[model samples]
Target: MARLIDLSIDSDQVIQHLKHEVKLKTVYQSILCKQIIEKASQERGITVEPEEVQAEADQFRYDHKLESASQTLEWLEDNLLTPDDWEAGIYDQLLKKKLADSLFGKQIEAYFAQSKVQYEQAVLYRILVPYSALAQEIFYQVEEEEISFFEAAHLYNIDEYRRLACGFEGKVSRWQLKPDVAAYVFGAHPREVIGPIQSGHDFELLMVEEFIPAELTNDVRQQISSQLFDEWLESELNHLVYSQ
Candidate 1:
């Protein structure tokens, strides 16, 4: 049997490589997942049509704004991929998505409805500072109407865009936030100023400008379905047993 890599290096070097090379684990996981996907796809008689693969490849070009064939070819060269290689990769991805949909698409709506709260979005303003006292001062000023949150954010926020936009983090779901931050922000009423909360090296002042409760829009349903399918695939992969 062929091993995955050269074993000619010193034992200490091998040990150090194994310890420090994080991407090696990810590569191994990808290989294992592909094997599983291939087997499952075959058993289910799932196949990718050439037209579908070509359409996907065309869409990929369109998405990247590759207007000309030469541009597409140049992009392929830059990415170290040939046209056939790119098409094959797209085919594999499409096959996996189809298989996942076949297995789990029917469950998406119920899952989205059940887990809706996690998907609720908030339009937020924030001021992040290194010191708690400064964060508190800014929060009080915003709260008292002495300074708008945007003004405070523009003046004091450490984040680049927050400094420019007055701390607008845009619309974000709970899962996109740190656990403690999500807990505080999601529970807050719209337009309420809340914070001086610690996050990493910074204390943050948060204001919820608007709260958007979760609704099972077509897009949300699709997202929930894909998320559930991914979870199922992960669980299946974890529980796979091998025989010696």
Candidate 2:
């Protein structure tokens, strides 16, 4: 034990700070979730092999560029974690991953098939301006190729962040947009400019970069699995609370 900075704290202070930070409820929920996961995993015999944990730990160290044993030890010390604690954390993560897959891996395909449309994604560019006239002007400029969409966006977009991004909205899911707006964006073909769309006090011009039709991707599968696991956890937690 070496001190980076001298600190004084107690269990009561930690609890008080957690409460003040509005994190006590979240902390309780997370602890309860781990307990529930532990029981469920044991029941199903979903366990993480030591080798798997070691592999993950190796990857983690590499990702963080902890190139040597000393560096790895220093990193753990900086995070206030012992080697055992790090191994345990890795074990817990691996266990939850195994448990998630064991429970929901086979169900992902059918669930995806049942909810295909929800997975449709679009890559888009947009220019949002305060005036319909300005939006329409920008739209024709884009359509006629007098100026590029990205140029128009950077020059005229109202949002500072969007202006810098040239209005690039990455891989937008259908649910992320308003119904009327989504219809126009999703139905339009690639490179088709789809608005001067009136939205409250603002008007927006949209262009579809590409449409990624619903398909099962590895990332999508992982996402669906995590979603299923979370829903199951929430339901279990609710039932546990209600029973109590």
lDDT of each: 0.83, 0.90
lDDT of 1 by residue, 1-244 (tens): 2123453456566556766976566656677788888888899999999999989988988999999999999888767678898998998899988888888778877777677788889998888899999998887887789998888889998999889988898988887898888999988988788888988888998989998988778777667767876787777778773431
User: What TM-score goes with each of the models?
Assistant: 0.87, 0.86
Task: Give candidate 2's total backbone clashes.
Answer: 0
Instruction: Report the C-alpha lDDT of model 2 over 1-244, residue by residue, as the tens digit.
Output: 3345697666788899999999999999899989999999999988888899899999999999999999999899888789999999999998999999999999999999998887899998888899988888888888899999899999999988889999997888786788888899888989888889987899988888988888899988988999999999999999987899
Model 1 scores a C-alpha lDDT of 0.83
Q: Per model, state how many residue pairs clash.
A: 0, 0
Question: For every candidate structure, what is the RMSD over all alpha carbons to the true structure, in angstroms?
Answer: 4.8, 2.9
What are the runs in model 2 whose C-alpha is more than 4 Å off?
A: 1-4, 128-137, 140-146, 158-162, 175-180, 196-204
